[model samples]
Target: MKDESLIFGTRAIIEAITANKSIDKLFIQKGLQGELSRELMSLVKKNNITFTYVPVEKLNRLTRNNHQGVVAYISPIDFYDLENLVMNVIESGKTPLFLILDQLSDVRNFGAIIRTAECTGVDGIIIQKKGGAPVNADTIKTSAGAVFKIPICKVDHIKDAMFYLQGSGIQVVAATEKAESTIYDTNLTIPSAIIMGSEGKGISPSVLKLVDQSAKLPMYGDIASLNVSVACGVILYEAIRQRL
Candidate 1:
């Protein structure tokens, strides 16, 4: 983590928020209470920023400086508005192909997915504001700077995003091993969005319920599942192959 990507101290974090800086996540010391803390909390609620309360040791580990019970990670890339992105793609006369990620926290996997999405000419990538991986230095490096080339949108919830995509006439397909059909069976050449979930919990049941279709890669080996990034590549390229 680079020091340039962090804003420390209560007042500093508050100023960053006031300035409308893209904050990936906020960390506050547990049991922190004061007028400043209350004000910060109000701003966090108003801005819908994600935060976590941690021990003082965690703050100390992040920085030896006087952090004043607060640390905010700054996002390297600015997020896009989903509706605007969808409208733009439609206006361009291009079939919109989006990738929606559900609680994918691993930085490397997230980066790899972005890289593949960019190569596949995906219109955008949507993720939850809270549970998704932060666009940090590691993510940028892992993506080979493709993170900057892609339009990534942060939504309040993945389920809501799926609804919006479906409403816009895009088919929402989920990649999960539980599905009986293979990715090759799913038609991806049309306006569509693919939902990739976390490694531990596949896709959330609530979001999966909204998907128009579900498809999976055939696994013949001893391993039950492929890495999330590799699976993402497989599905995205399938879309690319169909479109080509």
Candidate 2:
């Protein structure tokens, strides 16, 4: 999609990546053949950047400029390396607290989670590189600038991050309606990472199997579930409460 955060043209994208710019997504026109396009593909592959090849009509919809078969959305904030962030948090002697999102798609929900995480003293927030919302203008607006204040890491896979966090002695807790224990009963006084799922499907089953524990929020009303962001806020505040 074309926006203030987007940069089109094969050469421009290559240069942006070379400059260490955080590209949220890249779109290439299908059957786009050119020397520069080849170079762009090579660079994208080498860097493990996510890209999609779309039809020319899709390219046209992305931007009216000379796209040269490539367009990318530049992230508003730089992403943190998960390993380094976790290491630093441990070394700092503060009880590690992290929030993880499993394929949460809505930009507004993503923003609200970030705001809540920031307010709750979460050390960082993690989301997958693909199948999740980007740190775009809408997200920034919804976050009210909290997106810039928090450390966010984009991981290749949610399960991998869970494994790493568990290895690092941080417990991975999942929030799901299926859980028997409510958040108040869950242990959050230790180093922990709480995962909130997508708006539609909740956490993927594969990812859920990797978590050390799963808990749900108490619901007195007839509604079966709360919104993802609202659930995240409740879970985060509970963690903060236990720590206090």
Q: Tell me the whole-model lDDT of each prediction, alpha carbons only.
A: 0.92, 0.91
User: On residues 155-206, what C-alpha lDDT tens digit does candidate 2 reach at each position?
Assistant: 9999899999999999999999989998899999999999998999999999
| TM-score of decoy 2 | 0.98
Worst 10 residues of 1 by lDDT: 1-10
lDDT, residue 21, model 2: 94
lDDT of 1: 0.92
RMSD of model 1 against the true structure = 1.2
TM-scores for all candidates: the values are 0.96, 0.98
Candidate 2 off by > 4 Å:
none
Clashing pairs in 1: none
lDDT measured at residue 194 in model 1 versus the true structure, 0 to 100:
95
Per-residue lDDT value at 218 in model 2: 85
Q: Best candidate, TM-score-wise? A: 2
